[model samples]
Target chain A: MAETTDLDVAYVARLARLQVSDDERRTFQAQLGDVLRYAAKLAEVNVQDVEAAAHAVPMFNVFREDRPRDWFTADEALQNAPRSANDLFIVTKVVE
Target chain B: MTAAELPALTISELQPLLRGGAVSPGEVVDALQSRISEIEPQIDAYIALDFEAAKHEANAADLSLPLGGIPIAVKDIISVAGQRCTCASRSLSNYIAPYDATLIRKLKAAGAIPLGRTNMDEFAMGSSTENSSVKITLNPWDKSRVPGGSSGGSAAAVAAGAAFGALGTDTGGSIRQPAAFCGIVGLKPSYGRVSRFGVVAFASSLDQAGPLTKTTRDAALLMNAIAGVDPQDSTSLPEPVPDYTQLLGREIRGIRIGLPKEYTTDGIDPQVKAAVDAAVTQLQALGAEISELSLPHTEYAVAVYYVLATAEASANLARFDGVRYGHRTEGVANLVEHYERTRAEGFGAEVKRRIILGTYVLSSGYYDAFYLRAQKVRELIRRDFVEAFKKVDLLISPTSPVPAFKIGERTADPLQMYLADIFTIAANLAGICAISLPCGFATSESGTQLPVGLQLLASSLDEARLLQVAHAFEQSTDWHQRRPPL
Candidate 1:
């Protein structure tokens, strides 16, 4: 078994942009550690020369005609937004 | 027609009656509504029921269309115009979809009335419906036990005869496991077989929407309506859609079936094993050549799935920041806090854990160690199936190791819960199509009879052959005829 190190729980949570409570962080650290340790069993497999497979069936660059088409009206598009202003989604201020 | 009789009719049985003018669509919807009224309280099978809209749609339904006014329950993850597509998460609890998903558009175009949105694991996350923020969907067979999830409600609804058939999204056995636990037929079409234009993404690469129905024929009818290339979804297959229903009565005399030795390990429930073994005997009697094969890398499937699926989920879910749509945090000072608080409040524990784990794996130093290694092992796993298929026409296994446990049985241990999908996740990883149907009944400790699922997997886009063999087995057996007592 690869000697596992304690996951930097806080740093990882922040990177995911999730505000996990301190209690949740502690609980998750142990739980996530268990999952990762179990997942470490993958190292036992000799995949030395195998190519990585991403999507199941190999199809790529699935493009369509580059032409304008009908789409959601501005009202329809912004209907689900928590807050909207003049058909634009409103969000917390990000700039000065 | 009485509510008692409505829950017992399959889509094929109802279609002729509907076409012959023996029943109006309103009466059909009313019969189903009555059944839903009788059972929904006990099963908790739906997130939102649109009786008025369903009746209105039914009244105006074109009986000349393929679906012929059949009412189908949709998983809350799939959008239906003007209906709430909650995905069973509080974040989108109040979010009503403005337009229909591609599947919904096809179903509606085929004259299928969308009756209601069913419950599921929050954002299609967990194996059991317990993850839903909406309500717990109980197994129609035994209320104390759970309906398998993240498509639990759809399975339970169909099992309870609340809907003739339903739609479900399978990421990692979400549709099949629940269908097994609920004693229904669930098909997870090959990755690109069904379009995912508006279905909420859990793991983009693994997610495919399919059907949960009482019989294989019903699943096939649904496939005919919904399985087609959609220009809106880039990953949708370009292959011409076939009439899947035409192959139902076809012969399966010389089909080669592979029984992976890895799937028959000791951890499987004895009853489930016996049932699948019995199913193999039945298939053999029908002239299918059954042979034991090895998917040697099977042991790594769950581990690889978690690594890759979570990585994809972490990235896919990033779109749910508190900005555009979904739930947003209030009183946030800055962008960072807004994103943090919104996600913290919006997502469930399992979703958060997966996101964090996904982030950890895809993080800078550990990418090669965890994510890359898993991807490489995934290739080996896929190659194992490729080699096995060279010798066999299809692979069969028990859908879940055990039947449905109590709702809280595996909640404390995420790893234990993840193992619930040990048998079903590989098909999703390999991007192949698979189906689960009731094999037999196993009595629980309390003498409650639970259903076991037998799974059949086929190579990518081979649903025609997959459905044909499954339909033969289903017609030869009485398992699909059994209904849950709600």
Candidate 2:
């Protein structure tokens, strides 16, 4: 089993942008270990040389013409925002 | 229409009556309203009910389309022109979509009325709708137990007869597992069979929208209306979309069905197993050739599913930053604080955990060790199905290991909860077509009877064959008509 540490859990939470409670942190460290341990079992498979099937369908640049087409008005779009100001969604100001 | 005392009506059954001028769209919507009013408090299947709009649409209905004014619920993850697409999270709680999902456009074009948005696991993350920030979507048959999720509400709505059919996205069995737990018909077409233009991304590689209905033929009909390629969704498949309903009575005689031995492993409930076995017997009696097969790599499916799904989710959800739209938090004085507060407030526990795990695996030091390795395993898993299909015409399995459990049963145990999808995740991983339908009943201590489902999977673009087999089995069974007590 690959050894997982609290640092790993903390780093992950940071990346996920979540605030993990300290009490939950310890629990996650252990839980994350178990998950990684189980996932580590995949190392046993011999898939060398097999091409990965990343997306289900083949990819191509399928962009359509950038012609202007009237869609929902900006006012209609902002109608469902819980809080709005000046015809745009109003959210808490960034600290910076 | 509590699940009980109501025999579920499929779109096919309602469409003819509705189109032949025997029934009005208003009648169907009104009947559904009464059903929703009777059951919403107990089942909590819908989050937003658009009765006024539905009535307006029904009154002005055009019956020339294939759907013929059938009422349908849109899973919260899917967007509708002027309706909220919450994806069941506080951040997107009031996010009324600016445009209709491609499928919703098709439904509207086909004359289907939008009943409402149904509840789901927040951001389509969890197995059961327990992670819904709003409320638990109880299985219609047993109010205390959960309807499987993140498409749980879609299943519950269909099961409770609130709608003839509904839309759901399958990202690691969201559609099928819930349909199994709720005892309804749910289809997850081959990964790109249907466009994903407006279905909130859970795991981009695996998310594909399909139908949750009461009958296989209805799933086929719904899929027919939504399966064409969309230039809007680059990932949508270009395969020819055949008329699946027309293929319903197609012969499956001498067709080989593979029963993967791994699916019949130790932990499956005896009742679920018996129900699947009985279905297999019924299929055999109807002319399908059945054989036991081995998918030795099956043990690795769940592990790989979590790893890859999370990795993709982390990448896909990165777009929900505080700046452009969605929720934001105040006070911490920086971009980072805004990002942190917004996401923490926006997402639920299971969703947070998955994002964290996904981000971790794709992070600097772990990418090669975790993400890349899991990708290789995923290739092997896909190959396993490819090789298996070479030996059989299709495959069958118990949709879920057990019937739906109580709402809070596994909420605290994330790993235990993830295990609920062990059976259905393989299809998403392999990007294949699959469906789940009621097989029979299972008695539980939750003061109600529950239903289990038999799952059918077919190779990509082979949905017609899958529907033929499912329709054949459904025709031979009476389970689909059994309703829960009010």
TM-score of each: 0.98, 0.94
RMSD of each: 1.2, 2.5
Best by DockQ: 1
The best candidate by lDDT is 1
lDDT of 1 by residue, B1-486 (tens): 554586679999999989998888988898888889889889899988888988888889999999978999999999998998888887887788988999999998898998889999999999989999988999999999999999999999999989999999999999999999999999999999999998888898899999999999899999999998999999999899988987888889999999999998999999999999999999999889999999999999999999999999999999988676789989988999999999999999989999999999999888888889999998888889899889999999999999989989999999999988999999999999999999999999999999999999999888989999998999999999887765
Which residue pairs clash within candidate 1?
Answer: none
Supply DockQ values for each candidate: 0.78, 0.48
Off by over 4 Å in 2: A58-68, A71-96, B1-8, B445-447
Over 4 Å off, model 1: A1-3, B1-3
How does each model score on lDDT? 0.91, 0.83
lDDT of 2 by residue, A3-88 (tens): 44533777678877777777667777777667777787777777778666676444767777888888767787667555577878
- The most accurate candidate by TM-score is 1
**lDDT per residue as tens, model 2, B1-486:** 233222257788777777777767887777778888988888899999988899999998889888867888889988888788888998887677888889888888888887889999999998889888998888888887889888999998888877789999898888999998888899999988888887888788899999999888889889888898887888887778888888788767899999999998899888888888999999999999999999888998998888899899888888776555577666766667777777877887777778888888888777877788787778778878999999998999999999988878897778788888888998988888999999998888644688998999999889988999999888888988777675
